[model samples]
Target: MSVKPGAADTSAAVTTASWLPLIVVVLTQIQASFAVNALTVSMAGITTDLDTPATSVGTAITAGTFAMAAFILLGAKIGARYGTRLVFQIAVAIHGLAMAAVALSQSPAMLFVAQAASGAVIALIAPALTVFIATNFSGDQQAKAIGYLAAAIPAAGVLALLIAGSFATTIGWRYSFALVVALAVVNLVLSFRVKPVPPQKDITIDWAGAAIAAVAVILLSFGFSGLNSWGVILATDAAPFSVIGVSPAAILIVLGTICAQGFFQWTRSRKAQNKPQLFNLDVLKTGAERATTICMATMMFVGTAANFLIPLYMQIIQGRSSLQTSFSIIPYTLSIFIASTVVARLYKTYSPRLIARAGFVVVAAGLILLAFTIRGDWHQIFVVIGLITLGLGQGAIVALVFNTLLTAAPKELAGDVGAWRGLVHNMSGSVGIAVASVFAVGILGTLVSSQLIDNPTIPASLKVESGINLDQVNFVPNDQLVVTLENTSATQAQIDEAIRINTEARLRALRTSLLVLAGLSLLAIIPAGRMPNEVPALEEPQPTKGKK
Candidate 1:
């Protein structure tokens, strides 16, 4: 039943294809996307239910993405050794079980573990989706299928927001994950109808490289995530451990960077020795491919940061309900879905470099608009416009960069391309959320402390007596702040002043964070310029180069 390496299944040709397989692929994608997005929309409920901070949900998100980035290259090889269909089906089943664990999670620890498990399973599913398309379809049909798969990410977000938001509001956040469990069962059933890809039995798994990659990513994720809690430059009270008075976050980041370099060096040595590589370096042999990766990572970082910031502001800062937060961000998610679906039309007319550069400009403009216009209201016309504009740029770039990479590489390396894509996407997303939280929270803490010190209305004696650690301030709703202050010796007037200071400080912090992200969006344009000036024609793959 095994086909020759890189050979397509002619039975599933474009003219003869039923499109049912694409549906299965897209639905499988939605299953994972919904799990992540459901967690995002349910952030408020999760914090209350688990008696944890909002940052705990962000940590869970970081854990999931970090696990995926760490293991995806290995997952791609696993899919190649085993049959893609069999591995994908098993991953989907395991992912379903993970989602059920998330639904039943009683603590933040349980939630983080469940999410990380789901992410590891997605590493298998992500590459399989690409391999399925490469093996089953040819020509424009393959292009069309890839577009649908990309669009499904944002489409899943919209669905999760509505469904999960409703469930979180009406019943509880747990029901949202229960719904994903159902979707997983459905996806698993439909997967049987998809075209099968035979295993490449000769493919070897690089265990050493996998171990290096996993350790590197784990360190980087924890480093970035702990920057605030563990102190940016020195160990804080919250840090579990430190190295020579320096923050463990800083130490971990340095070690991670070194390990990442070592991984590449080890892979290069493996390539020279004619041994199997954990990832196919040939996929990135060209500058255009490398640039495409940078562009992809930048877009994901900015987009994820913005997405996280908006919801954090709405739910945690403004005290909006989960359903209300979902409704507010609908325009953004809907725009992403629409843009991802239709961006392929431009591939024929414009070069990727042109489209990608223009997309960055649009994204920068949107972020800048958001920074200046946001206020007490989340329903403003300008805010909605900004969200739509940002989403449009994000969607177009995500789809375009992915398509460009796939077209540029030979068909045999499709899984590698997909693995690299998933790695960059998830790694950047994890860092994005981590950095955004740190920046926003850090700024808020600084502003609150400064204001608390200088304010003449609040007596210094009362501040000292309040016992609130200004250095460790966190974002809390005004009512909660008031209750805490009321329990202390502070009078009503002092509580009112504290509330005013917190409100203004939170707004200022968010504005500052958005502006910084907009600057990053502008910087990404440099890499976009290095993308392919012309569309890459999908040529028949060259023969396998002797199997490494």
Candidate 2:
């Protein structure tokens, strides 16, 4: 009754041939994982070269995330029908070509188009990679493979930072995207070990459900993406349109929620009619799975926020290079890789809920520490200690939650699990980055306005004539702020006052953002507690006696 089509799930982990396919699947995952992190580190260079605001680059990133979250279910259908290996092969080729086009794009709009194209193809690559592993490995081997797959994310991110940093410094940021071309080549060559699963010809694809979900995800993502730019509550001048003076961002969010509910209702209706459903609702039927999903989303929310804010602060605000950002993150990234790999050993002893709660607690403590420590000093010993602590927690929770979700489902539902994983994780990451920007900028604007109004040294006339618009403030180095003030008819005294205020304001924004992120981390402990007290024990596969 399990929905595996065409290909047979391997027996006893295939001690010989399964190794190759496992490696291939992990490579496919790493290739897809490289996309966003590379873009994140290169954001400043892109914004500068394209002559656009910071929000423009942020929107492009969010648009790609939206495309991936919206189309991921349809991608699952494609993978299930056309087969994992072929879908992966073709998807990676398209993804690489699109990224190369992204490198060539001379404007923000063109970059958005290219990244969106790549996100659509990545949706296919996401689910197919999971399915490939399930079909080729089982038991102990499957468990080990899943750990590698989980670790591949941070591993890819680390590599992306290094490569993007190098390219960003010397050849130009455009050349950084060329790295994906290399990934595509390796993925294509190694993907042969993964067998194709036959399409379920009888299962009718649910186009209506897909449309509803797409509308829900895009609206929600776009709405969140503009929270800072378009205003959080009331409409700002950036509002494209508003209803009754309310922010379009809030309105779109409400509409998106309604559409999301509609998706669930329609899926239920399909099930009642005994028609095919787009996603396997059965995967979410258990309490453990639902809790795991919540924990996963929350982790990504904080994790992605950190990823975005750190690079924004280092490269844009501090005038550091992308290479500096990479080295700064090495402690965190390496800890993630190491912890994720090691936590699999502890699952049999410590309960899932226990380990997960511990991770969140550590993350919350670390964030709180950063809130107190970050005062224009990212490389301080205390700051590095906090980051390492957070990384250890992040690494463990991800591995624990991901493995829990995988084991909670039957092998036949691997594609469903993978698709759902992509949707929640990427969607949560987009939301995280958006929320971070919103809080940091919104707080900065308020703090800056109050401080400016109260300052004794800067006259109101001089402040007004400075041509500095806090409402549309972009992250720039203090030096750039001085350069930007060239248009102003302000005196040297007023300019020094402006620089001092902006500098203090920047640190305030960074610290407050960390406070909010810490709050979110503490709140996640609820779901972490809801995860299964312990994972069910499956018999570990015995090694074939004659196998090497």
Candidate 3:
């Protein structure tokens, strides 16, 4: 029997259809990239148009991030019960509406609410995407496709910043969100093309588990974001308990953990004999998988921190235009795309662990170089870090973790494991952004405070030169640091000096943060080593598979 081209050939159909699932997954991730960076790129215009305080605007971002972390697993459950295709449609609609609402927000409350809604969509869609791909694809296709999905996010982010920044500058920041609505529509159309996979028959969403997880993530995110806010954490010296009780960090660590543990116990109690449980305890039981997951999150966190800081520094300190700011981030997008799409494939032959470990070493060395060599002549350091160091680390992490996690998971529970992995990665991204914001605020404030004390003779000029209006500066830094700096009133010499100082501070902070990431990256080596050295021989799913 001669095989007809693109007709009645199972292998060809599978190959063509394989790409469709990946496309769907990539589309889902794109929504999040826009959500995270749209606000960042549009911050300047949004703040001005809405007449909201900068800190309030910053808090809106925090709210969105918290909402995502809280709701991601819930999304996965939805995908499991219904099919991923159905869930994707609903998510796209919600996310699109949220974006539209964000564009029309009249108050900070409206903005925060809209952002949170969008974040929830982001949280759910990401895991659903991973689960969908895991269930649909097999063997090397799974690893390579996951890498593409992983790479698509950062690439989308870079494009979003560029487009948003350009549009926000020319038209308005509110208008920039129109892109999301458009993207959502395109993604919605794309979703129709994705074939439905078998659905989980016995899906049970643990509401208590979901609730506890949400509360815990919100509290933890808040706590991490408020790291610089000692007063918020400590309250008054006389009433420290009040501060402690309200502190997100404290609640997440102490109360959140209790809730999470209770949820786990509840899941165990509810699980039937030989039935798979939500949040598989077995996955965590594997030391290598556990470490790999943690490392996955940390890698995303550190990369996000760099992405967050570089833009703010460029805009706030360098006074670049939005278009210029976005352009500067091009290297990151290019590098990550190349590594994810190209380098990831080589993992089949080379040890993924070695590739990932080398990535961290390069990243650490790059960060150190950036920290030590930041001066007036060292403006190109951002590109080096983004293109080479950060890009390599991110690429390898995607390739390594996706490959390792897939290998470790049994065929029946692949979707769940993939969802869990996506959860760790996305939540870590939020945590990273929040943590970076905290550090950025502290860095700006401390620098300004010191400058004021040192140059009391020229305090007014110093204030302007340092780019520190404590209230406004506390707002999250985006890719527009250059623009923010240009808006300041420092003379050339003073501007140069300020850039010099801030650059050093940022570089040093980046070094410290990346070192933490390097340590985390090394942790994955053990787990990757434990992964099966070769792919198992391909076999079709048995007719009596437990999933359906």
Give per-residue CA lDDT, model 1, range 75-187, as digits (tens).
Answer: 99999989889999999999999999999999999999999999899999999998887776655566678888989998888898778878988999999999889999998
Assess each prediction's global lDDT (C-alpha) against the native: 0.87, 0.80, 0.65
TM-score: which is higher, 1 or 2?
A: 1
Candidate 1: worst-modelled 10 consecutive residues by lDDT: 1-10
Collision pairs in model 2: none
**If the candidates were sorted by their lDDT against the true structure, best first, what order would they fall in?**
1, 2, 3
Give residue 257's lDDT in candidate 2 (0 to 100): 94
- Reference-based lDDT, residue 318, model 3: 60
TM-score of each: 0.88, 0.87, 0.77
**Across residues 441-497, which tens digit of lDDT does each residue of candidate 3 receive?**
665566545654566343566576645665433533333444555676646665565
What TM-score, to 2 decimals, does candidate 1 have? 0.88
Best candidate, TM-score: 1
